[model samples]
Target chain A: MHNSSRRGFMGKAFGAVAGVGAVGSLVAMKKTWDPLPSVKAAGFTTLDMSIYPEGKLITEKWRGKPIFILRKTKEMIDSQTESQATRDIVVAGIHYMIAIGLCTHLGCIPAYIPAEKEFHCACHGGQFDWSGQVTKTPPPRGLDIPPFKIEGNKMILGEVGPEFQAMKDSGVTL
Target chain B: MAHFTKATSVKDWLNQRLAVEKIEKVMASEYWIPKNINFLWAMGMILAITFALLLVSGIFLLMYYNPDVNLAFDSVNYTIMREVDFGWLWRHVHGVAASVVFLVIYIHMFTGIYYGSYKKGREMIWLSGMLLFVTFSAEAFSGYMLPWGQMSYWAGMVITNIFSLGGLHMDGLVEWIRGDYVPAQAFLTRFFMLHVFLLPLAIMGLIGLHFAALRIPHVNNQDGEEIDFDAEAKKYLDGDKAGSKVMRFANDFMSKDMMVVGIYLIFFFYLVFYNYGFAMDPVNFDPANGLKTPTHIYPEWYFLWSYEILRPFSINIGLMAFGFAQVIFMLLPWLDRSPNAVPASRRGKFKIWFWLLLVDMIVLTAMGKLPPQGIFSTIGLVAALGFIALWIALPFITMNEKKV
Candidate 1:
């Protein structure tokens, strides 16, 4: 064969070899890629919000339920306080308000609407007021408030403060 | 109009209309590479291998991987790692390759920046790279969620939560992105969808375009000189020249690319086999429990610098600044009013400024890892300011540069 023909043959031969190699590696790789195991959401911890920064609602998990570590403004706190007798969701915040972020109607997480200052569930259109009061229907009850305590800068979730002890001792339910 | 048969060669079939043999000769066999590129140019070859490595490893991991919020960690840490044969190998390869991809890309990026690869007619190529960079971040971020580990869970929630920085009611938007109120099965599913399909496709498309752009513009050389292909070719075709002035793509550059890829694999495999979890977060081994937050939350090392740089400002400002920093790089060519397309190394002041920016990034990354208190924030603000200053100063510094 001439020099040009020899070079053409060589190039074709190289391409063929490379193609085969690619196929072989892909086949080998398939063994590893064949298993389609599900990726579950992992455990997570939000960074400690020392003093639960104002106008912030950080989500935490408590017993598979999302717990919102919400810092209420002074006005919001007063509004809840004025209506405290009719409706209360336990643990009156000296500061941050903590509530299980699940809808009371069905067990679905509700998105917090900052403009409306309410949590609205997408599943059933369940809405709760800023203070966890049931504002809209489908949700039979208000948002379930979690047992939490004010400990320095952090709002300790799923744990009660000394207020719980004092209230329990005094036989306070509301 | 002859129909191709089973035995007909691809070259023969393609050559009928495509002139496959001739085009290959011209583009690959006969096309010339610039001879002056240093070892830094080898990074392009290494990066190509990194993509394949990640794809194969990722596919394997995905096959064994479960995306359910409840079962993600167990399947990855236990089922895939302990139960499946060679599962651990693929997992490690995938894990290590993620970091390796970023490492090479970082080197490639700085190399490009320093070489002024984005200058002049090459703006679109650089822009495509910037798009690739963005897609890589998205792909990596989505991949981070698949394991359903602590880091995956929290990182998913935290990063998506950043979208709330806009003035609009982003709560609904965040929920839509998360597919739930917070990071949950819905969020995991969306991330899986992107990581498995959408973003990968985008990356593949971008890569194709990136290569096309590179080929069309020809590789930028150190001297910022353009190769007059036809002139050189005519001279070489004539007896006037002993050989072609430019390096042949197939015999010269491709061979070096292949050799460099082989060398890169040695290092890549070493890291994969010995330190599989080197790039992964150890905290990610534990299943996600939303109640107990980690002591200190941090982003991946690649993003740690920006995370720190954007740390001081409120969510809105910090978020904006972080985004602007990456987008700024994409706009670098336009931001640079200087007529010079010369390599950044040649521009003495610009080189110093770039190093200062690198130093600033180093400091910010350290801050991102540390507790944002005491001196850290002070240092972070200074570094952040310095970094921003360097980027913003690009046009001013290069204004007087001679247009090559």
Candidate 2:
């Protein structure tokens, strides 16, 4: 009886050690899947806000995703609801609508119509107003705003500032 | 027989060490199969041949294909198509087989369902087959991304985004899955690894398991009748073969299976030579652009039925329905509470239920290809809701069935 108990105890101890080694190996392997340092270093993109004309939408690539930058006209700024105005990013005393170009429905790029002042996703017929708020069915939410900070007339994407943090706190952007 | 008479012969010596004769008898020559089954029983052999074709063609394509994001498109379209000898033929064969294999799987699955093959003793066979289906789907999806075309990039984006739980804002998980904010070099290399090495290894192991699971229960037949296999085998051995209801799996059933496979290969190569364009989407011919998306983005036809279910509803509910559609087939052994293991045509209400489910899936597939507008939207909504309704009613509708 005593010998059998000793064998059981030794088997359990060996199993416990092997289990810990396996878990450690898995953790090491999983760490290799993260983005490389060079990729992380290329994350932030800075665009001069003054170069884009008012009411004209321009697409810039930030970390391989399309970022839409549209300097709002006076009429576009005036037409926003009180809720929509809170989502707008104001840079150097000028209101601008900046959002990731991929639609929330299925990640297709939404095209901006200059005359209608709205972005339409042709893949599923989802629409977003000038402030990037959803105005159609299908798309569960509006266009997502990228993390950014404003400095003078330059806007840097992928760096969280207080304004972006406020939007995050209010659940306006993710 | 003559070789076994000599003890020093290689066949006799190896048989003594390996018990080769015993294994051959147990697995093939003495293994019994019902005599009533038809050509549908040959699908398992057909699928194995198609998988072999895919592996050979994929290896030929991999010789010159590059996995880099910057060069992958041209490497496939220019280098492989124009430079390598008979490269287009291999691509055409691989493309058609990938699409045609799913059609054969659906026919195989519905055959199992119609004849009540997932009854008491055969649950593991059904489960392993379903596992193979899911793995093949993952294989096809990963292989689609290797060309790095317009549809490949956008489809990768849409599918990876599903990891972001609808309202929970799990964008971190989505980005982690992609290894970036979007599909790029890292995403391309990871999918390439999955397509070439990891997934194919898993598929080969699962195919072994699928065959192993079939060993004890044996294959079901068209009538779902229970035959006394041992008695029939004994009768045939006693020189009453004309009256026996079973045949040996080796020479008898295998000959029938080979006949079906011959006809199937002729049809398969016809598609590979002439109708291969139907398998390669026109939109995917263009290079990937992060700034642009095709006007109508849709998955390949095999997935369209379930993809349509995700549309026409609110986001969370749509995702829930889609999740249910993917997994409900795995639960068929449990959800069906009928006492009889007979064919669906003789099971009263199950006949109507079976036909309706097939028709609804066809309607969903048709609507999934069209733009969701006007009449298509209404038909899609009704079919999607009807699909959920039918599954919910399954257990109750089947519980009171009279045993045949």
Candidate 1 residue lDDT tens string, B139-246: 999998899887887777667766755334265556556655567776787789989999999999999989888876778887877778777756655654446566
Tens digit per residue, CA lDDT, model 2, B160-260:
87778676668878777788888889999999999999999999999999999988888887889888788889998898887998888999999999999
Structural similarity to truth (TM-score) of each candidate: 0.71, 0.97
Residue B115 lDDT in candidate 1: 81
Best by lDDT: 2
Docking class of 1: incorrect
| Best-performing candidate as measured by TM-score | 2
Q: What is the lDDT of residue B382 in candidate 2?
A: 98
Decoy 1 TM-score against native: 0.71
